[model samples]
Target: MKNIYLLFGICLAAFLLNMALIKLAVDLPEFFTSHLNDLLCMPIVLSICLFIIRSFSRNKGIKISLFSACSLAALYSIYFELYLPDNSTRYTSDVIDVILYFSGAITFWLVQGMEAGRKSSAIKKAA
Candidate 1:
């Protein structure tokens, strides 16, 4: 839980910094301007989803499942990268963004695993 919160905080902070840079008209590298949001999308989104799920469910220990996380990333990638670009002039398809979405998903999964590991370790210690 603490690991997820930390991950969420870091991602959220980076995201806010990116937004602040954009709003302030600060010139930044293309990666920061373009890909940072893509890289951050899933972890932040999934963390919020996990928070909601935990809030509503009887099981507070619930985390986003790997399959669900990857599936969402794939769906979001396709929607933003494939579908939107063809449908709207405002959106351009970027393959790199698709890769970043999956990377974010994997990051969330790894951090969530860390929290699980920590819980197990605590349980073992308590025993």
Candidate 2:
């Protein structure tokens, strides 16, 4: 779907920007590469995961459920906050990351709802 492709583009762009901010440039604010970096990709990753799960699922309605969004966010937060931190020294465990993950998940849910509403209106107009 177009939206999925767009999400991929956004994800790729964000990742590149994060990398550039952290590695290529020296004078840029650390917030962009450090604190905000964890926040930046959360929504994109969650959205992509939701889209993929929805596409593969037998129940199409599962895509719009808040549970799916929250579950994915929780899983992501646990992995990055707990498992990854324990396994690697590059990333440290932070409670704010979990909060950001929830924030991103909520944003994704709202966006998806709006997108669905738009599609519905378009279909009604076409009919």
The candidate maximizing TM-score is 1
User: In model 2, how large is the Cα lDDT of residue 112?
Assistant: 71
lDDT score, candidate 1, position 12: 97
Model 1 TM-score relative to the real fold = 0.96
Provide the RMSD of all predictions against the true structure, rounded to 1 decimal. Answer: 0.8, 2.9
How many clashing residue pairs appear in each of the predictions shown? Answer: 0, 0
Residues 22-102 of candidate 1 have per-residue lDDT tens digits of 999999999999999999999999999999999999999988889999999999998999999999999999999999999
By summed lDDT, the worst window of 10 consecutive residues in model 2 runs over: 1-10
Best by lDDT: 1
Model 2 has an lDDT value of 0.72
Check candidate 1 and list the clashing pairs: none
Give the poorly placed runs of model 1, Cα more than 4 Å off. none
Which ten contiguous residues of candidate 1 have the minimum total lDDT?
A: 1-10
Q: For candidate 2, report its TM-score.
A: 0.73
